[model samples]
Target: MPEATWTYLMDMDGVLVHEEHLIPGADELLAELTGTGTPFLVLTNNSIYTPRDLRARLLRTGLDVPEESIWTSALATAKFLDDQRPGGSAFVIGEAGLTTALHEVGYILTDRDPDYVVLGETRTYSFTSITRAIRLIEQGARFIATNPDATGPSREGSLPATGSVAALIQQASGHAPYFVGKPNPLMMRSALNRLGAHSETTLMIGDRMDTDVRSGLEAGLKTILVMTGISAADTAEHFPYRPSRVIDSVAALVGSTDKPFG
Candidate 1:
């Protein structure tokens, strides 16, 4: 095993790139570690893109990650729903990214009395849609959400993410959903399994305290919080919890030779 036998779980957006533009040193850093056969995976909450889609996009951007190295909330949600209802139809409120993943995994997407209603971050979220999903839940449909992140990264500022939509639905339906993204043990389990990572030798890094950071801490892995993403500089000001290591960006982790064996 390598000195840093630690498997690193990296978040996709903000941490790796903003939109389609790659961060300055992200590609090089990724290449170096991958060349050394260091184990790592891109654990993303964006259910908009498939593993194969993301793999090819990353390759074009100069990072050579394979399909297995990319895990998304879409995949986790699909797996969870597959276990709950095989070939089930889901009423969705997200992007094509999520619907594509569900479709690929054998889920039948529908809105006519669906078996489950999966909500996500959709630019087109509205009262009508929320009411429809809420009605379905009230009528005994299972509820699922991609992630509970309330805010997302954007040039203008933080926009309402899945959390906002989820909160609304939960408010109306009087029932919380089964979230399948960060901080959820199911996602952590799937990620670790795919990476062949042991909690004793893995690191989870991200920018959100409630989701990414909290999830990493819960997974019994060393956690690093970076300021390059959603969490601002003074984010920890009112917070009691802190990550194991605080860095300005993923660049700080680029070539650190420290292993996680301790």
Candidate 2:
């Protein structure tokens, strides 16, 4: 029997590039995918930058990913809101990526009696904005967050992310936000939908067992846990579930894209 053609959903930060540096074999794998016209999306939970911004950054590292091929938690959140309540209004606390997505989806960004209080990643979280979000949620607006990642990596150290801010708002307003990013399975499903790919023929490659592998497993896709990111070599045994396979990095799968698991 001929091997099934595989579609790829890949995590960006640790798997492709780490701290602005391209990982070994990243360019080669991407070139192969593009050359063959295989469907793929570069996925990220970070909501700070738009896809154009991310594409430029990747280009700086010599990776030629197209802007439209990047999928973000911000985009997923916007899509969810658009589906749940089309043409709704939201008071969003995020950067360009989040705001741009909401705008594209025709959501009205406002602070006056909005229908939802959306929280996303921002380098600087303002107490004033957070206070306003809490008040809006208290006023009966639903709470929604892009991702549940509590901390983000930084050169200095770990920085508090969207999930941390969501926790604070939940404590003050007694309302927990519905996270739409990885580990939720919603993110994986959304990416699959965007690629027009089915879970059975798709492969999810990531460096984290918690977010990437967990989400892919739940979404019924084959998951590959790479050792180049947050999860250490021995990390998989601690998780209740296991990935479909584990590898050193994307470099190992360069020539084996047709049958990654085999």
TM-score of each: 0.86, 0.98
Query: 90 in model 2: Cα distance from truth in Å?
Result: 0.1
Please, what is the whole-model Cα lDDT of each candidate in the order they appear? 0.81, 0.95
How do the residues 136-163 of candidate 1 rate in per-residue lDDT, one tens digit apiece? 9999889999988788766887888898
lDDT, model 1: 0.81
Which 10-residue span in candidate 2 carries the lowest summed lDDT? 253-262
TM-score of 1: 0.86
lDDT of 2 by residue, 1-262 (tens): 9877899999999999989999999999999999888899999999999999999999999999999899999999999999999999999999999999999999999999999999999998999999999999999999999999999989999999999999999999999999999988999999998888999999899989889999999999999999888888889999999999988889998887887877
**lDDT of model 2 at position 24:** 95
- lDDT leader: 2
Predicted structure with the largest TM-score when compared to the true one: 2
